[model samples]
Target: MVFFNKVGKVALGSRLRLMTAIITDDAAKVYELYEADFMPKWFPVFYTLTEEREITITEIANEIGHSQPSVSKIVQEMITAGLVNDNLKTTDKRRNIVALTEKGLILSKKIKLQCIDVEAAVESLISESNHNLWAALEEWEFLLEQKSLFKRVNEQKKMRESQDVQIIEYTPEYQEAFKALNEEWISTYFEMEEADYKALDNPKEYILDKGGKILVALYKNEPVGVCALIKMNDENYDFEMAKMAVSPKAQGKSIGWLLGEAIVKNAKELGASKLYLESNTILKPAINLYHKLGFEKVSGLATPYKRCNIQMELIIK
Candidate 1:
């Protein structure tokens, strides 16, 4: 939900965003996908087949963006394989009329079914992503595509254009932005009462005294998001999990997930077996994210607190 640097220069950390795709022609599974959908359900790319008219081999190659020789070879292979018919009367007899055989039509239908399977595979990988994540990916991809294709931007040039986000130990240097974003977030979205906002700003020092790690997300030189990790030492309290809060300005752009990912990755680096989080059910989007990241439910595990209304945990390997 970032809207900060519009028409202005931004920092490095603000520029790096991640996109995920399940269907990549570059992967080995591409063959699997191809096998799934090689047959045409009205093959939009092939005009003659759709119109039941004759078209030259060159026309198909141009439509599919393949070389003429390669298209001819594939057509020849399909004819021999009985998946297509290429022998037909044309305005010119030497030129063949191309159409799918009965076998090819059946295979095309089968492929359409397998494309459904490909979609299932994609859904499984990310679990169930939120609408926000999917929508953000779509918008971001279009922006990046415009820059890469039309702007003729190179990889290194794009890197230089990206923001410089740093994930480090949280210190007093970040308290201002942290406090500012949190207060603004409460005021803007949650309509949080004065008591709730005050309580958040005045979190107990004892909680911070433990193994709390602060992660500050900066766009170029400005602070955009902040996450805190409070380690539970058995001396004070036994069970523990990570804690995070992001700014309203940075709400919908997956900054929270960025912060969450950094915290989880660090948890693995620190060798924590199970990472827990405490949040109110009122924050439905955040809760849904925990589910997407493989976190399940537990009762009464939340501690060090008064702010949380619900509890969730993730077991990290």
Candidate 2:
């Protein structure tokens, strides 16, 4: 027997390939010993054609779970060996049909008897095992048909991540996250200015002490996003929604939208009349989200950061 030293410990795919090769080799030997006129590989196409009588190459490929090209190649070989006939359909000249010849029919009779013995041998081997490998294989195939292995794994990963995400009011513990999340994006796109650092580094002094509120998004209890609503004026209840950030890994799960919505809801509770924000035009997706959340473009707004070229405001009605 051919063997690799670590083959037994390999993954399922490698083990299945090895098993298929071993079984095909053994079946070829058995066919030779019985003096069968056909190879083991030809058995599937031959047996299917015999049962199907007259069928297209495409039909045989579908029935046997093989590519049409592969079945067509095998059919050509069978035609050359005088074991099968390939003819163009009179009604549909474009379609080619395959049928077993007299010699193939005789071989099919012999193979049918041999197949019974092979089935008994396979049953005996399975009966000796503690677990039913055949039933497990069928179950696995059914599950895979329902959804591909790749899609199932990806959906599972998304579900686990979604379960861990939670949005909450900011606390002292999230002070570093408030700074780090904002700094990460600002440093990547534009230089971090003094105003950015002041607001990020000292949220309590610059924001909370000024009657503003901050919100943080947590993934598995770890802060990944932050957004702040700064009080602009007390008389008209005006506020500036600024200093929003989400980590690179936590960007695509609508975390920013959730943070924005949470802050807007808080603004309503605080009796704010207008919510304003300063941002650059380069941030297309962020701007798009702002537009979606009822924020519209407005000119002539003073900004502390140099990156602020576009200003938007939402009238909280």
Candidate 3:
């Protein structure tokens, strides 16, 4: 179709809205044909009133999965149409209870009859179509609940932007870039401890010379992120993934993720069994990224940094 060919999949919201308008327009005509004065937007609220003889505005909103203000507006519209009443107070006297008027009860009989035909007609339409749109809609709702479209699109955006990033091993010329990146993030969150300075100031002696490895992420030939795998002689864990930092300018480009992933792959190639990491709960985004990289919380470990309140481990082997 020209619509899809022109706008592509990004027009999905507009397409769905157009189809919904068409369906609701048909619904309004059906109500008119039955001589039941009703608006299509009022069906959800009206149907809930028939099921619950008396309900508060908040209760109606919960039942219909709508905003409280929206339900209140609908209630006011129904009240003006002389089809509903909301003058009674709840037992607590804090909320107004709503119910259908005598005129609404008469119109309910007509709507019930109209619904029977509408259901059959909808079923027939579905059976004749190539897709089971009802089931598909339910599945779409379920998937969206699991992961929203916003997060999904952001993931895609990050992945695309990260393609421009290049992960490279440590080089002498890039030492300042690595130090400045780590210091920027550390000083922003917490004061740098002696252990941080020992590692950052002398990576060659403290990390690389001690059998550790550092990786740098370069975007457009400029260093944007850094991560190090400090070799550990522990019986359980083989390496401590530490000092991960990304430039603020490159925050949303997945530079941290790419640097962390490179460190993991570097560890696996070095015959490491597990990778340990220490972080603070205050860095929620970093903690979430660690979890996404398969790190699980673990206890019973000693740390040098006061900011290290949480420990996590990833088993590679």
Highest lDDT, which number?
3
- Single out the weakest 10-residue window by summed lDDT for candidate 3: 87-96
Candidate 3 or 1, higher TM-score: 3
Predictions in order: lDDT: 0.61, 0.86, 0.93
In order, how many clashes per candidate?
A: 10, 0, 0
lDDT of 3 by residue, 1-317 (tens): 58877999999988899899999899889999998889999999999999889989899899889999999999999999999998686667777889999999999989999999999999999999999999999999999999999999999999899999999999888889889999999999999899999998999999999899999999988899999999887889999999999999999999988888899999999999899999999999999999999999999988999999999999996
**Deviating ranges (above 4 Å) for candidate 1:** 1-164, 187-208, 233-243, 302-307
Write the residue-wise lDDT of candidate 1 on 54-142 in tens digits. Answer: 56777787776678887787777667767678767667877766887777667666555655776677677557655555567789778
- Rate residue 184 of model 1 by lDDT: 72
CA shift of 144, model 2, Å? 1.3
What does each candidate score in C-alpha RMSD?
A: 17.7, 9.2, 1.8
| lDDT leaderboard ranking | 3, 2, 1
Considering summed lDDT, which 10 consecutive residues are worst modelled in model 2? 1-10
- Candidate 2 yields a Cα-based lDDT of 0.86
lDDT score, residue 21, model 2?
A: 94
Poorly placed runs, candidate 2 (over 4 Å): 1-10, 155-317
